[model samples]
Target: MNILRRAAHAVLDLEKARCEKTVKLFRKLGLYRRILESTGTEPKIAAEIEAQMLSIMEEGILDQHTLCSRFVRGELAFVEFVQQWKVWYAEYCSWCDRVALDAFRQAA
Candidate 1:
């Protein structure tokens, strides 16, 4: 299936803006799974990859929520919160890309 190449291409094509909403993020993840499933990846392997991606997405959301909570509590200035969010989002995207690549390679 050339899983590694497919994964890399999909990750590269991912649109950060399109994934802003939680529902959209979930849909994006589902697309990833579908991409694998369509390529004849084993069901177990596809599920494992989806699990890994979901776990990473969950962690990112939790961290983002914590940041928002802190802002609401007046623990951070709006500017500071935005700066932190930018950094956090960048790291999250990088981690997502890495996980997708690694997961697909392992599956292959």
Candidate 2:
């Protein structure tokens, strides 16, 4: 599969909002593997993937923050939101660290 095609597919799996079927189709395209292969120590591809992953993480965090804020304003129990947010935030940070670190190494 093409690099872009694979990245698109993996992106869906990693963080898709809708059209699960379509994304699944792309998911079947072996995007994650392709992306790693495409990188092939190219550095650029690594940077690209890193950039995309970080952006996705940021968006997820922002959305979750907004939702949590809304619940707070609504005087709702935010335990669930807070818990999920903390978990996701931790995962996101881990992902961010991995990608950003790769990007940094590539830039170096």
lDDT leader:
1
Q: Write the per-residue lDDT of candidate 2 for residues 1-108, one digit (tens) a residue.
A: 357545644554444444434444444564543675575645466547644664564477456545555554544466877776788788877877787677657656
Best by TM-score: 1
Q: Estimated TM-score per prediction?
A: 0.64, 0.37
Which residues of candidate 1, in runs, are more than 4 Å off?
Answer: 1-35
Structural RMSD, model 1: 13.9
Model 1, C-alpha of 71: deviation from truth (Å):
1.0
lDDT of each: 0.71, 0.58
Q: Candidate 2: what lDDT?
A: 0.58
